[model samples]
Target: MKNQLEITLQNRKNLHAILEQTPNEDLLKIPQGFRNNIWWNIAHVVVTQQILVYKLSGLQMRVPEALVDKFKKGTVPDGTATDAEMKMVADFLLSTITWTKEDYEAGLFKNFNEYTTSAKVTLRNVQDAADFNLFHEGIHLGSIFAIRKML
Candidate 1:
């Protein structure tokens, strides 16, 4: 099996492609407020990865605090994002994934915190964390796709 970082990188790439296929206007429409829009979901994934990799693993995360609230979990866009801002966040997410892979290979992750879920145990190391994150990303991706179909 590929390492956790590789799997996560692949998932990120796949998600980027999926997002690109979504029309820009469709990215902002949330169906019934049950789920966030495509853009919000994408941003959430980026924020989540940064939080887990940087805060949880003690790696560097350059994302600004001001921007963190904008993309942090449960923060939906109130139609406040300019086109430029949306694009910038998307670009930054892609870059962050690349940087994370480099750091992973360099052994920057030292923590091996076990992650438990009600369903099952998820991770036992950085590699495991990466795998779990990739799985989580898929869940987000599914939500995005389902929301797109609804909208």
Candidate 2:
């Protein structure tokens, strides 16, 4: 899944530039029918990776616990994300994936605690989680795109 992972990450980076170009007002605007804003969706994708991969494997995640709690599944955007926060998200977007790749190469993920996603897909190991993360990110990207249209 290495090549596929790279492609997904690249796709995210490309999409992220479009998101970054969004006006802060638009990025943070949660349309009446939507559960989250563009910023929340983007940050959720990043936070989800940490949860599905690192947290499930019992390893320390790169992102802070507060961030994970704020953007993880079932959470909604409580308020607007500032420009500074969005910039941080943009900077970390690719960096987190690159670090995950490097860490995977270093064999840091020795054990994976199996997990079942809300979609009912069960992931039993690190590679499984990694592959699942691509799908998860894709879903959010689709959401982001839709939210962009609403904005």
The TM-scores of all predictions, comma-separated, are: 0.80, 0.94
Q: Please, what are the lDDT tens digits per residue for candidate 2 over residues 83-120?
A: 67777778778888888888988989999898999999
lDDT of each: 0.72, 0.84
Instruction: Looking at model 2, report the run of 10 residues with the lowest lDDT sum.
Output: 79-88
Which of the numbered candidates is closest to the native, going by highest TM-score? 2
Candidate 1: stretches off by over 4 Å: 112-124
Candidate 2 TM-score versus the reference: 0.94
Collision pairs in model 2: none
**Backbone steric clashes in candidate 2, count:** 0
